[model samples]
Target: MSDVNTTRASAPQWRDLRETVQRNCDIADARYAGNDTLCTYLLKMREFYRWERGLPYSMALDRREVGDWVVAREQHWEGLEAQDLDALTLGERRFDPFDHEAVNQHLSPHGLVYGAGYGRGARPLFFLGSLIKLEDYEGYRIYVVGQEMARDLSSPPAMSRGERIFVRRESIRRMVFEMIEAWQMRGAPAVDSLGRALRAYGHDPGNDESLERMVDAEVESAVWHEVGEVLAGRLLGPEWQERMMTVAGSRAERVMRAVRDHLADCLATLPALLDDAPEGALHFYFANLGGMRALLFPQLREAYEGWVKGGTLEELKRLIAPAREHWLTVAERLLREPPETWPVSDEALPSLCPDFSGRRLG
Candidate 1:
């Protein structure tokens, strides 16, 4: 076998940064209790991994939906004059955060008289009506400030909702790093140490043959469930949920099962690609690597940019094989691990590995 010099100089670990991000998320969740806009931003940031992986956008009700509920509440703000009606209409429209004029027009009716300032520059802005929405059901009002207003309304480093959310997300990232670090300190194992670590942190290890199995199951479930919802929504329109149940019902189970099986098959072949790796390199690459580049490099032009920026065809040629190999390792490992091991929660499961195996990647 030909040896590939796959050495990489290790940089500072990301443990601190990840913890900071998680702490910020906690702070944001506490600080902005009833502020729907602020809460949504913070929540999104806190859950960056889900989004980055292209998971479903957290379901929440929009302003128009909320206003409709408000109308049902208090008997539709009964006995208001023509101006009040216009105001209510405007208020309903303005809940979108993108509709500033409507919000400005209906500020008084919407009870937003407190400092309803003009939107920054010429861009429109509207407060988010509510962070949660349910059809034919009333929900609380939540407001959000747009990016432009956040920038303009700031006074000497006062954190905006965006900033707060960013901090929170960073905290989450840090927490993940710390978990990985703990695993490393324990002598990086190939078995299910991640599950054990999760259990130590009070998480469920789940009933699976291996930690990789649990992770794979969870990811598969999450992805397919979201995909089903998306497909239902697209196919059935507004009544997708009901229609999906009506049409597919138990069939959804069969479909997901098939998809999972297919995904498993794809995952199985990944390990073979790692045979040529320079020893412990695969483990390191699999644990740290992320993003689409790891999955779909052929479709990405940026990968090609590596060829353009570097000189000598040989140098470029040398880099591609290793990079591809690294990604292949990551894919292989992901398929191997259980999904429960992936999420960083307080209630983690126990590691399958009584004695840690494998060497650390650098």
Candidate 2:
């Protein structure tokens, strides 16, 4: 039989294996609910193994499949042993599911009879069951199916299992967009702060090169076109044809204006505190300002807050003065900085204020 035929013959049997793995994961999830830290860690390990290798179980106890499963199982067991499981309750009965002697006695002539639980042969199987679970079974399914598909095609497949699992290009695009959405939601404050710092130095935050780098060209086109339609709905009261014809520039400018208005609203809430204020008052003012900064730059908020609460206003200001200067330089350079030089391409922003190559007053 050809390799393809061999894989085809094996495919039907794989379903039962996947179902068993899923069922096991579900059991693990139920058993470890209160002990979430251990549960999550073990579940993630199972997920990683499933993704990296295939399922850690076999449909038949044939020497090849069973031996492979045993090794994978032992590795998982050793990992679990390294963790603290004192708080876990196995309900007064620690179950030994794999027994070597019984397995050995009942084996088919071609089958390997590993002992059930009591002997050396059963030890590896016993350890394997301790860590493998079905809670992350879907991920395992994806992993196994993806791996099988890839392995059947070639020794190392051209496209990854992730690509196959996420089939259609549109589906992959949607997944990427969802990832970007989640990231932005979590990092909104930091992004906003970076925008504010850019605007403070007379740079157009809307035209920020860093922001452009973060979004792919195709996505950018789709976003702005959607923004145009939304703006037109608000401005011209939602006539479909009129909205489609509205200039993109007009929509973009409106967005920039709205952003600036929102910033003005936030600035209005700031409480007055001067450099000469007492340490206590300075701390209060710093706390309040830090809160505003948090709304714009969440990543730096804790450190900024710590600096504020640590000492007198003068001392804090002196500590951050260099950073403030650096921020100014970065802002000024944003307009002239080559697109290739921006660190935003790597999904990171400068940790501190950074200097620019050339100075442009505007």
Summarize candidate 1's per-residue lDDT along 152-222 as a digit string, tens digits.
11111111111011111122233344455457687766344353334433433242233333332222222
lDDT of 2 by residue, 205-316 (tens): 3444433332222222222222332332233232322222332233322222222222222222111223332223332222224322333334234444555445433433
Worst 10 residues of 2 by lDDT: 151-160
TM per candidate: 0.19, 0.19
lDDT at 350 for candidate 2? 30
Report the backbone clash tally of model 1: 39
Mark the regions of model 1 whose C-alpha exceeds 4 Å error after superposition.
1-175, 178-182, 185-187, 191-362
TM-score of 1: 0.19
Please state every model's RMSD to the true fold in angstroms: 21.9, 25.2
